[model samples]
Target: MRRDQSPFLLANPRRVHAAPWETREPDQAVTVVGDFDTALTEVELHGRWDPHLKASAAHVLRTCLVGQPAGIIADLHDLADPGGESAPLWCAAHTWGAHTPSLVPVVVCLPTAAPLAALITCRAARWNLPVYASLPEARAALRSRAPRTDRLTLHLAPDIDALPLVTQTIGEACAAWHMLTLHRTACAVLTELVANAIEHAGTRIDVAVTRRPSGLHLAVQDHDPRLPHLAGAVPGDPGDSERHGYGLRLVHTSVTAWGALPTRTGKIVWAVLTAKSAGERNRRRPSTIPGTTAPRRS
Candidate 1:
């Protein structure tokens, strides 16, 4: 994949015409572009939002929400929904986001004059979806309502050297956020994730560390669609590859919860390390990993 000129573009390679977080239809009737600025993920919708675009748009929103961004700003200024038929979509999205363990905030942005503005306010009123006239206003409102989070991101090559860099970054983030207790586990989880990508994916990687109120969030994204799964190895047995299920096994034991999500270009393996009690951690685990089906070879 060729790199684009978007400032947000990192090591994770994407299509020449689209950013890693962007999705569009062939006819270009609708486009969903997501931008992650450490603190939040901004999803901008362009073109018509009629029935034809509803399914694609919902998928994009679900993908963004699954990544557990601290907050979301859904920009709909350019989306035309004259009849407000898309109001239900926004309502469902907000409901879904709120139900996440993190309770990720999802806000909408559109000019007051836009046809969808009044409809969203009236139809989505029960969901209490915040609607803003501008991005700045929406961002400010979300920042005020959402929990404060700190984040660090690094774009690295798929090499063994990236391990130390990722460890160093995680150490710094944990220290800076006063999460020294989680530093070791955080580093262990992140390094294993990056190392797995380096060995199997052999593509550029984007590593991100986010400090949330509950714990540390670590994610490693690579340009390979193959999802990681726990090898069906008997306990106390180190499978054939020497390091075979070792990395993911360590990650599974060290983190409170871990899973993978497919991206436009590849996949992101993420884990959360928390100091909470085991009971609380159990409550945080999702019934199933998002974007994951039965395990399969790449």
Candidate 2:
């Protein structure tokens, strides 16, 4: 969790985006742009609404929220009304945001003159999230509102022997930042992420943690461009209760926010956890070096 020395002189934590938005497929309906630290999901809602479209869009938006704390943008430029099944799908998107851990879904209704723009606005209002009429305004608002904090990155190989070192390093960093309360959650998250990489991806991993203004941002990177997605539950399925695919689910329940995104080389999965409380922060802020105390002011 140590900061890598910058080659340049000035170091600004707010300017660091460890994972920027880069997409492999140019034709995807839902595109995720950004990394664990900050991201924007642009979804183009065109064509006739079908069950396949609904499922696909839902899956994409879920993955976007899972990889990054930010929400997705529903682009309604080519439609007069969502009509048919897509309207309900939009409601489902809003419901997903409400149930998922993070900001509500954002909509970009371009040109202001699109026939269904006003209808889209009304629909999004019912979901309680704003609909922007311009792309620049939407991007500007989302970018400026993303978490701005210092980030520390670590690189490790795909070996089980390295887990201990990774855990200890994360614990030390959390303690140093008065975030000792997050040590357990951080350890669990890091372990699950690294283990997944070692078993499935079998590639070197890059782990980064950013201490945000109010919480912690943890991202795990591996050389697998395929995004991790949740499997649908089957009725009366024994595997539903089994722990095979429960690692990320545990993460989803433990943290305040979590998401995943595709990197140029691989994929980065990230989560945001609540930091120590005011009282705990106060207690840990002073008392360093075992017995040292701050000098009293006159």
Candidate 3:
């Protein structure tokens, strides 16, 4: 069957395949062999759950989380040595997912008779992570618990006109999602991201606006590989025009969390905005970029 015609993509048309990661020993590699659907992402793992394999698995899971899927189904039935030692990995992933603004859920799939089944269940129970005996069961459980999410995607050229269009889109998304409280902040953060892409990348930009239970999720993708960094200006200082770098500073202050992820063609700058009172919003500041392992801070 054609790659795009696969059942996974058929069920969720918005899903896309991500490049798979492999280890030095091909047989021991862990691969993300599923589509990245907004509602759920399925990650299938093979080979032993050794230290080296665990590192690759962690990276794969981290990348999947960056997409902000509503839930994740990790299928480890094919793993040669899915022992209890790797239980901590799933727990850590569950913790990471819980920390996201949307609180993405994660479930595992392994045979009931597998050696790691009981051990994983005991360890994962502390974090409330679920383990199913089959892929169908895991998928069903995750889908049942997945939060409602709405998304809008737009592709535009690297031009100034895209700014107003982006603003309009965010406004519509917020209104439709009944998240008017986040409309203003969402517009501000997304505008900065798109403006930066248009100014620096000078390439086509892909914009995504997603509404989650917490608030809004915004991402801008451009064909420029260069990641963004914050300016050296003081927190409250408005520097001279030549020294000005407040564009991202405004975004950093307005959103709950923000980070950059590199893609094959370019990079994606994403941010999450949670509903908060004006006083709380004013006092909020980002300590460290979350979701991705090596994210560029703004």
Candidate 4:
């Protein structure tokens, strides 16, 4: 870590967080602060924990609730766990519940199997905390919460040029969080998707962007009538000669929430960067492009 870097920043890559915490050190980095008006009291995720980055997110949550009894209202309604690895979730939830009596954790997960439910059953049984299936139900119980705000969506061509286009578009609109790493990540993802669309899906691509109260939304469309799956940022098929195959890995790694949506043509791959990350992504685009040998631009 640099003398100027925060100790809490990711020192090594953890399997938990995909690639958002990919780099050993980004040119610009921010300690994610959950904002209640201002990140005064909020959950801040640090480092990488695979399927979910919430592993260390309890830090800000605990800090925010210190001395103050008013707890936070967390929404885990849309959370997806593919690996069946619940350690991180259990760690984040159970540990937080134990530490903060003032900070109430609203468990908002979708209905799960009896086995899966068993994992979180302890939370409800012990804390008497309400576990809701949707955000609406959870919102009704919380005392301090705001109604969901409007969503801003952007749809565009999946042209190779789309990277610069979308980068500039998102950079300008979401100027509040101007982290260049976000743009770089977006640019990298766009490059891969558009390339895949052109090569495998028969070009004819589409992309959309939306800014919801919770985060910024991005959707890319194509006409090949095919579906894409999450793959390692580094391709396991070493024999593969595909160019930029690892793009989606970073896309998956960078945002808070992301996935693919079925479309009439192919599919729309989307991702969301939380509003909390605005300040982080907007910090500054790195002068030197990652992995390049050239010096940074002045």
Candidate 5:
């Protein structure tokens, strides 16, 4: 992406590869990957029972399964967490298994991270999922299954003033394809992710939105160094009463992908939006409406 046009673009050295990238009408299949596919989809847990995290993980697995005719395989053997638990990753894996047409997901765990190594070891001991320590090894298991493709990574930040711009952009992108629901979802996910990043991550925080052919990406990075936890989340009292948390679950349903990143300072909570554009025309609306209450611009 060209940063000379925007400050946010500076942090990311992307080519925005679709040029003469004609601001041509949005097509459901414009960019290669939206967000999650852009990188290894990941989640970090401050607690063991995070429905939000679990639901988000399932969404990514489903995204990977789209347009494919085989099982979804992911590897977590190479992830940087050495002391975490596979139990945390199970939520995503199980969720993916339940919804998608596959029983297993290719999980790659990077053992370089001591915490991750321990986590994977324990999970492997408990389950039958194949665990690997390298990306290539993880890819090899799925290569013959599906033709791997391009990936894109974008950032989403909650902006009090950018809603209109975002709405217009998304509305234009999805309306052409009759994917109005996706537009509504983008609005909701952006609203919550941005709000959560700001309210929990603290000020000077900015929501970054990145788009690719496969999905839309959003993240909020803040200066605070503390890991964030929802104010009053409790483990499964085992009831249908939804887990009392923020709108993240809602976000999990709206987008095709989602995940979080840890920063040296504070953490960056991000989500990948997996939707396609087809040039559906429409008008602009509030960026932070309904499910979204704008977080103070960082």
Candidate 6:
């Protein structure tokens, strides 16, 4: 019989039997195995639990989640903590949740009916983290969620001249996704965002666009931690057309939704443009009309 040649079946094949890359210390070990099929970074932890254990796990997890994979499979079946404390485990979960661009879905595997399992379950409820008894089960959970594809990441200097190039890059993605109708609206939102980053922060900015089933999600990362909110400015008159404050206001009016989050290094401002019927954008009203308030960061 011919073996399956599907990449899904063969992802990261060379590393199938490879020893997991490990981070070791006197009291603990955290090993990570890449399972590319599900875009999961499989991590296994073993040893005593302590405040330091949490910090060590955070450090290791930062490395594992570098590319912002779809999800994480954390195996704690070998963990040797007898005290049944879940704080150290939750620390890693918190770090994974706090990641910018997007939070990583974490599926934790622990022994069935183990003391630690109960402890983790109790706290997991508060954070909505998933706990499973086996690796296969954890994989199933990740598989059930909708997949998001990373379309592109572009780094540009803080220059207004880059605006056209940025819009062109966005146009390409919109065309490929069959969302050509959104091109105009997307360009407007992106131009406003990029211009704001360059003017206020004056640092190199990174822009990432991801395609989702519902829409295209755009994120602009800057060195400034300060978040931007939609200004009260409205382009109801000629004077407002040239105002600097209209940038975010245009963002609020054009995109379906927008928000901001702080990263370890800086901050990421994100917006989503809902897929719309051809020419539907022309009929949409400004987001600040009448009783409506400007979009606020969630």
Winning candidate number (lDDT): 3
lDDT of predicted model 6:
0.61
Candidate 2 error regions (>4 Å): 1-34, 44-46, 50-68, 77-105, 109-112, 118-137, 147-151, 155-165, 202-204, 210-217, 227-265, 271-298
Across residues 1-298, which tens digit of lDDT does each residue of candidate 4 receive?
A: 3422222111111122221322342322213222221111223223323433443334433432331212344444333444335434544654464464333443433455534344555655554444445444544555344333333334445444444555555555455544343554444444455555655665655554444434454555665544555443345755452333444444444455454423333455555555344334335333322321211110
| Tens digits of per-residue lDDT for model 2, 217-295 | 6778888776554434546867554544666554544565565556556677776677543224235443311111111
lDDT for 148 in candidate 6 is 55
Query: Residue by residue across 178-227, what tens digits does model 5's lDDT show?
Result: 44556665666666655565566545565555443445555555665543
lDDT of 1 by residue, 1-298 (tens): 1223221221111111122333354433333333333346676666666555776567667766655777777788777778777878887888888887788888888888876788777665476888999988987787777765577899999888667778788778977888876765566667778878888999999988987668777878888876676655556755554445766765665565665645567767777677752233234443312111111121
Q: Which pairs of residues collide in model 1?
A: none
Please list the residue runs of candidate 4 whose C-alpha ends up more than 4 Å from where it truly belongs after superposition. 1-158, 176-187, 190-192, 232-244, 275-298
> How many clashing pairs does model 4 include?
28
The most accurate candidate by TM-score is 3
TM-score of each: 0.58, 0.51, 0.59, 0.38, 0.37, 0.51
lDDT of each: 0.65, 0.56, 0.67, 0.41, 0.42, 0.61
Q: How far is candidate 6 from the true structure (C-alpha RMSD, Å)?
A: 15.2
lDDT of 6 by residue, 5-48 (tens): 11111011011111122234564766555432344567677776
Misplaced by over 4 Å in model 6 are 1-150, 233-244, 277-280, 285-298
User: 11 in model 3: Cα distance from truth in Å?
Assistant: 34
- The local distance difference test score of model 5 is 0.42
After best superposition, candidate 3 residue 8: deviation in angstroms?
27
Error of 5 at 178 (Å): 2.7
Model 3 spans with C-alpha error above 4 angstroms: 1-68, 72-83, 95-101, 107-148, 233-243, 277-298
The weakest ten consecutive residues by lDDT in model 4 span 289-298
